[model samples]
Target: MIKNILKSALNNFQAFLVTWVVIIIVNQLFIFGACFAPYCLLAALPHTFVIAVLLNYFLNAEESNKQLNSSKIDSNSDFKYTQADNHIEDNEFEETEIPFCPKCGSKMALRTAKNGAHAGNKFWGCSKYPKCKGLLNI
Candidate 1:
């Protein structure tokens, strides 16, 4: 996806450069005709703006459609379950008490901080606050 986006941005830049080069060449040609230069540029300006606007609109629409399709598939998947089903109850399970960090074997403790994103808000922080101070966004 990142590569695709980079390719698209490069393509748009190349196209924009080619278009302005052509426009400049045409305007230069009309300059030799004395009275037609201004008129030619005036005519080309509106068309260029229109084409640019249309391209932007279509690109946005395509991106929106891709997002919508992915979300639709996620929502329609069969594996999703509600919280109350009790197939996996969180509180019923015994929390593993670790005296050391699993990754580095350093001392660890049960701490709480803001975590996870809900709706439009993003709130995330390390479970070990004021000490570990590892913050994140979810």
Candidate 2:
């Protein structure tokens, strides 16, 4: 139900596009009905961008929390866990292997934003930089 929807949308690629397309379509319909101009599409960009950014922030935070909890539980096993599991390694978990870009089927590179509000945060960027700007936040 709700959990399945959230997991599917958060973890899958096609679901992401479907979810956003529906949102945009509905928003555009409302704007068209009220304003009756194709030019309003440009005005919709900022609204949609802000919504997407905010949603990404909260979803990423929740996903990180879930992973942290799961890793802690796993660290309790008989095998020696990494020092970070027992409070020795850096506070951050080791960077996991990056997945291929869902959009373009290209390799994704780990990149840090040199200039932005998220300047130091790491995210995955598509190898096809100028052509395909697919991204996945880490």
Candidate 3:
């Protein structure tokens, strides 16, 4: 019930107007016992304002998270992976199959082994780099 109110409030000004009216009516009838008193509506203002601010904060946060998630790589289409056997010395993956990191689940990127015995050879490394040391042979 509260969730529905919040969702509606996020999308429509009518929901806020309705919520304010209900708060004012309830305050005037139950708290003040003077249904016609104008001052009784004042008491509802703070309550309505606090609820509006809190709902706005939470709903906007949810919207931002949705946008962030939508911008992420699709995995199946965004990255191109190639056969591990076609080792190109540069940062480019040959053009066959994309592999996920074994240690973490992130997509792997083509990287060169700069200093080890396999220096100058190309392999798949975790896109996350220093944070995740997942590696694969190419």
Give the Cα lDDT of each candidate.
Answer: 0.55, 0.70, 0.72
- Candidate 2 Cα RMSD (Å): 17.3
Evaluated at residue 132, the lDDT of candidate 3 is 96
Q: Model 3, 27-102: lDDT tens per residue? A: 6678778656556566567886667645554656676567657777454466788778856676574456889999
Better of 2 and 3 by lDDT: 3
Query: Please, what are the lDDT tens digits per residue for candidate 2 over residues 1-138?
Result: 446445545565464555465656677877556543657767776676455544544556577578879998888776765554455657577767868998999999889999979999989999999799999987
- Model 2 regions more than 4 Å off: 1-15, 34-38, 56-64, 76-138
State model 2's lDDT: 0.70
Ranking by lDDT: 3, 2, 1
User: What digit string (tens of lDDT, one per residue) describes model 1 on residues 1-138?
Assistant: 545544444556665456555655565466435334576667667655545444544565576578779999998897767677547767788865445443444555544444545545543434454555543333
Tell me the lDDT of model 1 at 112: 42
User: Residue 82 of candidate 3: its Cα lDDT?
Assistant: 73
Cα error, residue 25 of model 1, in Å, equals 9.3
TM-score of 2: 0.34
Instruction: Give TM per candidate.
Output: 0.25, 0.34, 0.37
Q: After superposition, how far is residue 79 of candidate 2 from its true place, in Å?
A: 9.3
Off by over 4 Å in 1: 1-38, 67-80, 83-138
Worst 10 residues of 2 by lDDT: 49-58
